[model samples]
Target: MSSELLPPNWPAMSIAEANAALAAPGSPVQVEDTVIDGVPSKGYTNAPPNIHSILFLAAMTHPERDYIVYKDERVTYKAMLRAVEHFAATLRDKYGITKGDRVAVIMRNYPQWPVAFYAALSLGAIATPMNSWWTGEELEYGLSFAGVKAAVVDPQIFERIHEHLGDLPDLKHVIIAREPGDEHNHPSVSSMEDAIGPANSWADLADIGMPDVEIGPDDDATIMYTSGTTGKPKGALATHRAVIANMFNSLTCTARMYLRKGEAVPEPDPNVTRATLMSIPFFHATGSFAILIPTALRGDKIVTMYKWDASEALPIIERERITSIGGVPAIAWQVLEHPDRDKYDLSSIEVVSYGGAPSAPELVSTIKRRLPNAAPGNGWGMTETCATVTLNIGEDYVNRPTSAGAPPSAVELKICDPDGKEMPAGEVGELWCKSPSNCKLYWNRPDATAETFRNGWVVTGDLARLDEEGFLFLVDRAKDMLIRGGENIYSIEVESALYDHPAVMDAAVVGIPHKVLGEEVGAVVQLKPGMSVTEDELRAHVANQLAAFKVPVEIHFMDQPLPRNANGKILKKELREQFTPRG
Candidate 1:
């Protein structure tokens, strides 16, 4: 794709023209209106009924295509599918994983995570991918809430679950991924090597076949958990329709970007497969449905990271010839700002994308200055919206670096005042969106679901103003949720955990700005009179219940009662101002 072909005034030309061009007949990306969940939403007409069918079709079509690249492991489409089939059969035949059963996955960016996820879905079971960073208590809560029947987890996670086995009575099977000859290491654990063979052992599973199960778009496909103000993680239920719609939304976006730039639609790469660096945790909606599933179906290779490291990433990009990288702003910033960033052959990168963190306007210019060959991309959405509703890419992205860009054709965005009255452009209010990408509900939390998802619109907690040009400018947030290194941390969740300690009478949490991680978690607490608690003690208390990332990096002890409003709610905005250092 040559930027020379793009008219100098092409961006001066209306964005509508580019969008319309993509929607035109015979265009690589096409759109049509359809009813989903009783809402007349726009969606890709050619999308599969469910993700299982799509992955199955891709495996049958491009059996030898490289699906995943992790360190020395290169799993082809056929290999992954066969593993999925073998595991799905084991889940059903051996473990009695019937329809609607919940199967859990707890692992880093290992190949088994996808294999476990698909296998669970392949048998009509709901897949629950708990955060790999979660503690035993957090994982137990998710498992118990979703009534997880079986889980395919790594040895480290298995060690955590082992402590809670007696607590989780419904959890029958614990399939642990162990090394060769490390089988039967635990009395209750089943070796993944024994169950599914060794890593990259594709030839051994040539005889396996996909499961014969009837799945519908409306069937529950996943129960991914998201944090809220209540501290407890709520499992957000999403049907196949929602996930598949998100997958298609990604594909269409790519097709449109190439077509609008007059670049030929991307075909299967011959020298190296269309590769991406996937360091984001697979449990996130952005990682699972948005990037992982779409990349898999296209037969693109995902270069996995065992854990995020900028130095480790540089070499993978050079050796693997990774064309696309990024799932978080921190990843991009770290890579470009690395002391030895220029020492590697980073010229292979064509696109860099991230979201969930508040991006500095200067970050945009930095990307352009350093990685001139790559176009920077960022989008907005949350777990409720399947992680992408609006994306700014290419020239449009560079022009309006601060704006979140317009919603895709399949997504509709609107602003509403507190009373639910719709607001016109330029008014800052709650951002409500309607799209097939919206998940169904907050698992088991009817009150939260009713208040958030209402009348065919997901009432996003983001406060934003839409310009007359249709670009969304986020002003603030309605919910006191802060993103730290792309992971969403609800202030109330941390506060509730702090209050759990008897020594703490009142507590408040706020976001402290950080140059690298976007924001760091900070806490203010007032202990009970005559009671003593050290910062380390309270921090350890919170860590036991929540993930380590959610633990406060900084803590302050307050002697007087924390500031409060007339309604008796703690004033967090005031705390952020008082506690936050002057920039």
Candidate 2:
């Protein structure tokens, strides 16, 4: 959509003009040409040299401010820094963890997670955050794959990986957070309380100070594993620069939002506290790079949850005055449609954003209708890109509901055909992105790295198109697109149509085997509570928006939300099994 068609006072300046002003020299988010891993790319000139620098700045700037809020516990930046320093000292002095050693952080979204992560990075050790939801065998594979020397895990994760610890001989130390009184007689296992004390008492611990280690911008800082749906998960090795680039890109996006509104960007106001409800797990890039690091740098409070529950989140928002709420679309949907949402004082919310899945356009309008103070935001990113490649929010999202917002000046986006040839705008093809935030390589998988990372661009498997204004419209994953009798069908289109139905809460479209056609369109839908819809009614609703062939031949009603992976993407493979023929 063009700016001329946008709502009045929305996008007062063109996207190009906003980007030009933001990237000009002397700007806080100035963009510059640079080389990354032998390939030319654009990078932020003012971004922190590394993640530890951001942590140091945060601690020095906001010592007594609340940094992390879990259930009944609140940790200040001073306490967090103390814990990080003490843990770093323990890792170095006790376990002999040094630069270049891989230290795995396998835990849920707790205060200890960030402590473990920052401590390892501060010591120049590669911080590998494994999925806490993974099974014992999967955890074993991740630990061995990275050759981790030490691991910090929650009590539940400890039990999950306890049986596999003997299998991973390279793992020399294990620290369990909030361990129960039961004694597990393991040689390598230890308690986190012994290292840094409890979460609240961290500030009183003897602070040995940050580890004296040299960490360069291009040095490997993280090894984040991808959500393995098709095959074994590949670990994307990211540099310190790659992860920190996200912080600047987010700042640029925020500046652009102000410039596009014909308003000057405001300076930071320390008196007004900004808080975000962290519903997503820190294991994902969207959680770690996008939310965790950025919020810390700005001294924003992060109210975390053990898991996402709208009932639990609403009261926290009311209590903490959360300024932002985000995760997957399902998270925002539950909050907006919650039966008791009106019972709370949720006037502080300003942004309700989500990504990592296809969202219904209706969700945008719903947010506008229900929460007048909040603006609905969406973006497109992947594990390979770190996060925040393109952000669509506020009026821009309302104007082009389907298109993901354009990239910042520091990133390049393109559409390519199957043969790696660039495609023209409005053409459906694989979306490729090039930026300083792109991961260096897939750990221990040279062939996979060669296939995915072409030059500096990460060949994202998502099938998308660029509009004339550079807005991205995602069609579907390249592998998820189905062919029925030689006609291509994008599953997202059908899923979007299903979501258009008022009663539908979550929906997934998958291909079911057919004797005649190569594959038939099939759908699994979960309706909102107290809502009812027949399979025929849903088919008719979709038929009104899509072709007959695209309509689902079989529709399965689910009592619960559609199954998703750790990254909040719908598990179409598991849903496909529902259509399996009974022998």
Candidate 3:
């Protein structure tokens, strides 16, 4: 810890410096150009051997640090590691769960969720995190899709999926958490507390260490299911290499900021733990990649809310001294606009950021206004690219309010025309991104995988333009683009304009059927509480900012919030389905 050993001006290393260091020989995250699983892309020469290697490395460093926090219940890294060991051992010894076996973890944001996830991973099994918000039918599809061998669920989730349990042939084990005394007559069902008996308890298991499963970086790890807006949700299978690469990317970026601010990469302190409010469900990549994985690397405490409630979140932030808030754009909107915001002591918040949904430029400024000390950040990526490959923060973010910021050095983003030719800077076209953080494949759908994962690039559905400096401004999802007669309209362009209006709270623009024009612009808006506005007035508001064709041919208002999936992304397809276009 000598002063001269660190960066000259700052005790912390800059991202540029860190990047240089990473590229050097013997660096744990050092980079090299090579083909990974037939995809020519950037990859780590020193990527962690497996998921357990990464988790265990963290636990060994900060064993006593707080890992999970819910209400007054706190679980330390040591405790979590022990549980993971016990669960992994029990699954392997008692249940015959082994490598490549799929274990579905269906539950709310509880401490046991992570334990189950890591336990399965520790045994070289694929951890399938099914959407907690899914219905019985959806749950059945997921279990059947992954061929789930076992599932660690809670009582409430069991009730939702129990009806369809008979349909899943491969499901052999069910360890239900939170329902202590209840027992199931089903052969597979057992309470979580009863399963982790004294014979294979955490105390006994911690001494035995990880199982003898040798997992390589390219080995199967997570089968994260997509939102399935169009059809059945596709499971994006991420490798250990892909997941760990993302973790380093986040560290490099944050370290870059810390150095810029003349701060050091603080040593892991058990008492002085960094806290984040976990509002996003873990099923989403944003929750897993951007929040959960990165926080674990830093040994930071994650405080989970059973469900998203801005009121509940506010107190947790104040009491836990939560340093950052993120997940979805709606969470930020709700927090900054909450009527009872003044009642809580929310000064501890230092960062506010979100993605996975459309964001108005105004949401950024609103966050800065409410949390004066907090820096507002926004970025774009999808389930395919492991959440965030491009991230914009600080002055770069404030200056270019509309852009999804620039990609990290390890990631590449490009705009291409309809024919797949590269577009010049600032020209709008399909956005394609390539990175090691990109998932390996779409679980079992080879044809879909071939179509999307071409030549190491994720053929993102987003239509975007990149400035000369590489700031990406997302225009719309290519499929969502509307055509009115000969005129083309980007729904996001129109939605952003509507968001500029004072009364507009949440808005979505879609293309409705039109006999002559093929399709016409349509808007569904949820106004601020008690606010009223004419449809024509709102149309005029958009017309002022966009071309005439982009103005909504139809405007529908709603008394409630728009429909959203587990990730807080508005269900545009559902919105489009709600209306029958007139001739």
Candidate 4:
């Protein structure tokens, strides 16, 4: 599909039309009100606010507040705005990165991430964030899929780009963020410092004479690639309004919870800025939408650590007085178990949100004991949902840790069986969501996109349930996959590589909980007749073909014929139950 098909001016129903549909019979309601009142109603009462308006507000209202704080470097909202203007003007003036083009940002969590993101958003260009951990082959697939023309990459990963040079011929510029002592010497790659240079080298944005690239609320803003149960990953294309609305929904949900708990919100005193201890990778939506975007829009201070180490994170959080943090379930586990956790005065941590994967109920109790004010909340959404649809707020989190909470105001969720029939309340079924916060479509995969985004809802491929009181709880995924350390691992993709091994007859991948990694991949396999394979050999075979995350942690060889049912299909559910621990 042409990128222009999902433009900013795409047809969308009015707010009134949306509200009526969401409030229609049998929809999930907010858990807070449901517990308080006898009657049921759709959770959100407000419309999804425009993100472009919020950007303008941040530029004007909190101009002087600290917007980004990397080690020894900080940029105020005013300064960041100017930086965005100059860089965006540079793109227009130098490379012609105009509306509808995709600009790729390939880096870990850093100040440059949001700078590049908002710069692209400012010019109506879509920001397609690639996983920093992705191999050259994976990066090539993503770059080609999105038709990305340019990339702003970290110097650390720039060395890996040569492997895919031939495949990415359309790629024009490589903007590398130079480190100290590196100097401007690379012949192939352009130095970003040499390009943007100290944030004030370019002409004033007003005098640049660039046309105002106007983008509507529904314009494509981000393309987040998520692993599919099928072989390849798919890029979920989210709109500008969708990304902003999800951020607002997250903030509103957090604010409401604090109010209900009788705790006064940390004043919207624009002077009281939030400092975030960011360890989550920017490739994921939780890092970009929940942590980075919200902080940038609020003119908050961000402390970014490129590598995620538990020991390093705790000290940084305490030293920075980090007030807010968001990460996967595994990250929370590390922080709670840090050796010197009690030594630090982590009292400033008001909110610690978790997403990417479901958390065990035990983690919630652990968080409460570690940080008194901290409430462990769940963020539930797929890439197609902009990584947030249902969020477990503070109050609901304190009350019901296992619940996925209520759907965001801009979102509408429904549970359906495999046959696409709506399931009754409390019955486990595939979860589907519709929202202005939802992605417009998948990039360049029409068949997959059509199957996932049906009728108006994105079929998340996750199995879940809506309780009688309207709280959503995840059961499993309709698609077979494992989430280890919050990174998604597709079973079929891994199994396909295993099946190619000369000694392997069959294989199945399943998730098993670990004390450290929230979940670990366990591979159950059967060797071909009269053939034998060592576990280490099999592991090495798959490791070469797949990324580290997709490599199985445990390998089990079965002697008897692999378990199968009538019609000769492997009964994976029985295998999962047979091997997975119950207690």
Candidate 5:
């Protein structure tokens, strides 16, 4: 099925051939054999050794370039470096923070978010970014779980977790950025403005020089928490090498794309300012590893928003000349379908890519039709993989819209059955990935670490199949699959069919308990604004594409967008509860 989608000369050369030239010895993204945590693995030989080193190099290469843009504020690379240096100094001298200590960063997508993150990392402290959407109790649980010594938060987050501070004995210091008018005063709390001043004034601060701390490539760098859908969230601890490997892997993918098109990779053009709309939360792996760090290292501009709004984003894309804009399919869809989108000059966009959820196949054609200048892209990854294991972009994505593309030279992917045996091509099984970008382990959870990370491979819970050409087609999450009358049903298939309907905007398929059948297929759909469809019409839509047993036995409609977690994944457990019987 996949082979017919590509031409005989398409990609110009094989993926293996392209990698040989791109990752050859002495090349920028050279690959080398290495050992990580006693497990054999492959890594990027020429990548930056640590996050601090990358920050320093970025500052040196683009001192006057705009690094961050939020509302009316713009921070240059030089100014951002000064702020990170001063903040790191304060963390070291005032708070006695050092290598291996955990410092929590809990805030929205504010410019200070990156400042706080880099500050902690620069001082060799483990930067733990907790979800800003977590409630006070959830936030407290994360702080206590990581044994955080200090936290940098915004006013809203500070208010949310203030009362719970007494429960966190390890939390010794708290720094609030952009605090509102004289609020509740705590003995351990301090103002970020007082420490680093406003973003615009950072250039005037005295440079204390980069922190004189020794950091190794394999040292612990970040502890990102997974979404706690089934139970308590677990921290996925990653090393400096793991995070930096993702940067190189991203670069390698782009280089491969150009080579596949029979074109030489373009050199870095300092005159052309590359920019992206920062829509996703920085805590998520897709936002931090895939978007933030990569763009920062390239000296590109990041335009942030307090929250994502299509109406507000349309102008930002035009005003900032955003070259890339995507976090998830829903985000890209909103911008593409916006009523006033045609009113703005969005011709600056070149790529519209998304991941972390199932996207409709029609979305690819729609993007090509709506924004003729942009190429639609998709991929598959997880928090444990530190984002981006396989990516499908440009012509490859347009041809195989449902496939998750292919992995790069530094990464290995295999499909395994329940008994841990590798599955043959075209057979559905759990997708497992091995790469230097994979997280080291789950913090404080040995059982989970042992179960998920096997010999450097992260056993992703998603069920998928690879084609002859190595294109991945996700079936469904292992736990989310429904069995009806002994027949297996993958929800994504039904949801995709529902999305084909012109009126359907978002859809999720859940299993409803039955007396005789054991379980029945059920669907919940959100229609496009001002568009309507009958339940019978939607059922017929899916029935046409799938077997009768796969059709939803019942359907429910919602006026609001589907409920999603911070990672932009649909909360199926919540949707399932609606079908439960009550006394």
Candidate 6:
């Protein structure tokens, strides 16, 4: 190759190869379709499209690059792609995870999580990721709701499975990652490693060659459970086109804002290895569709964490030279406040993307101050939108820090009044989104499906406003709005102000019924470690900042942490349930 023809740091691969490095794995080339019982199944009528597209592209372009790192274990792109294929083959030939079959995965962030997830997806089986932190009751609800016939569970959660076993009568198999203490005594559970290892370490399946199984662009790819804020959690079905389209949109936005930002960003070289630290849970759409899929599609390295521990994450970021991070506000805050934070060389971090919940201004400012090399990007979406509907990118972020940015290329956004009439810019209303990434319907919940999805727009249950510049700002959950003495108060507004207090570690505001006022504001706050402040002082602090109606009439201090879901979202419903006086 002529020197002039290639840029100084250009990769060995040609531009076509570099471009292919980012392509999705098309339908599987040669794979057989297996049968699944009891599901109103859609046979593999389409070629192995999405998973095949991603795996093939990554293997061909960035074959030897690191794909995942879990503790001491590391797998390269070539090896990882093979593992996915091999496991997928095993599922088809050995197990019966066929098209449209519900295969659930219950594990924290680990190498096996993605392996099981994509393996199921490759077979045209609908992968369902349940929160690892879910109780037995919650797990039973999800298991039965998704019609989950089989599940890959971490051994740690074994007891929870046993608790719900009688209820999950349809469950045919339980694939455990670790070995059982005594095989005969362990019931129906079997070791996944033993089941798949004899076939070879999942890498051989990529090349073993099997008959082709067809899949469609619109076939179900994954089913993510809702936060269950309203009542019981419902599964939201995401098709291949929807998931892939979400990845494509995220890739485009990140390529411009995140991957291209710093001197350490390496000028988009196909050869310069990129790695990411996984902080988000595998069950959420933010983790699977947003972070993992995009990184895998790019053939970037992923370092897994069993759970987000700031002390452990900082070392990993410096050790891995992690280029990008995507997580909730809590993880970002934890990392920033880690004891040995300054010891780690976090200069390698370029983009610190955050979502899950609206970031506290203090946390946002803290990240910007501490990690000058990293910029905080916020996203807004739900399980229905496949993670990101609106993204705050580049200069728009500084101009409007509170805004969640504009809708991504793949999504359309609008704020509408209670009657579904479009609201003017800067006017608060229900935030609605329309996109291919939007779920087809709420699984088995026809009434919810109708209520949430109307005329192609998914009602997010979020109250928000779009600015003149098209930036979306979330106010709070519509259900969380407090109507006190004929005055409307958004809890988020009050909570954000409370967070500004140095003594405040966490804060949640809700409405309590009042005999005279109809309802009064009640604030629940947790103080920073070793910090102490009186309720009068806290109330005065807020009163000085916000309107009187928005100020808390009562304050409750807690020594314990706020109750949160797996994604780090405060479970206001639980708090309400706990605080409300029972007869």
TM-score of 6: 0.85
> Which run of 10 residues does model 1 get worst, by summed lDDT?
562-571
Q: Give the Å shift of residue 84 in candidate 2.
A: 0.3
Which sequence of candidate numbers ranks them by lDDT, best first?
Answer: 2, 5, 3, 1, 6, 4
Clashing pairs in 3: none
Stretches of candidate 5 off by over 4 Å are 1-8, 180-183, 580-583
Worst 10 residues of 5 by lDDT: 1-10
Between candidates 1 and 2, which one is better according to lDDT? 2
- Candidate 5 RMSD to the real structure: 2.0
By TM-score, who's the top model here?
2
Clashing pairs in 2: none
Task: Name the runs in model 2 displaced over 4 angstroms.
Answer: 1-9, 180-182, 581-583
**What are the per-residue Cα lDDT tens digits for candidate 5 across 418-531?**
999999999999999999999999999999999999999999999999988777899899999999889999999898899889888789999999877888999999887778
| Model 1 bad stretches (over 4 Å) | 1-7, 24-28, 179-188, 228-230, 258-272, 481-583
Q: Please give the RMSD to the true structure for each candidate, in Å.
A: 10.9, 1.8, 4.9, 13.5, 2.0, 8.2
**Per-residue C-alpha lDDT of model 1 across residues 274-350, encoded as one tens digit per residue:** 78888678888888887788886676778888877788999899999888888655467668766778899999898
List lDDT for all candidates, in order.
0.78, 0.89, 0.79, 0.67, 0.88, 0.73
Count of backbone clashes, every candidate in sequence: 0, 0, 0, 0, 0, 18
Model 5: how far is 516 from its true place, Å?
2.4
lDDT of 3 by residue, 1-583 (tens): 1233224544244445545654567754567887877866777776667767756877888887778887766877777777778778888988899999999999988888888888898888999999998888989999998899999998888998777878888998888876752566778887776655321233334456878888888888899998888888999998887877777665555544544445554545656667889888887888877787777777888889888888888888888899999776767877887788899988988888887767777877787778888888888878888777776676556666787776655778899987789999989999998888888789889999997888878899899999886778999988888888878788888888998887888899988998788898889998776678999999888888887878888899988778888887889988998778766
- TM-score of decoy 3: 0.91
Q: Is candidate 2 or candidate 6 better by lDDT?
A: 2
| Every model's TM-score | 0.80, 0.97, 0.91, 0.73, 0.97, 0.85
> Which whole-number lDDT from 0 to 100 does residue 351 have in model 5?
89
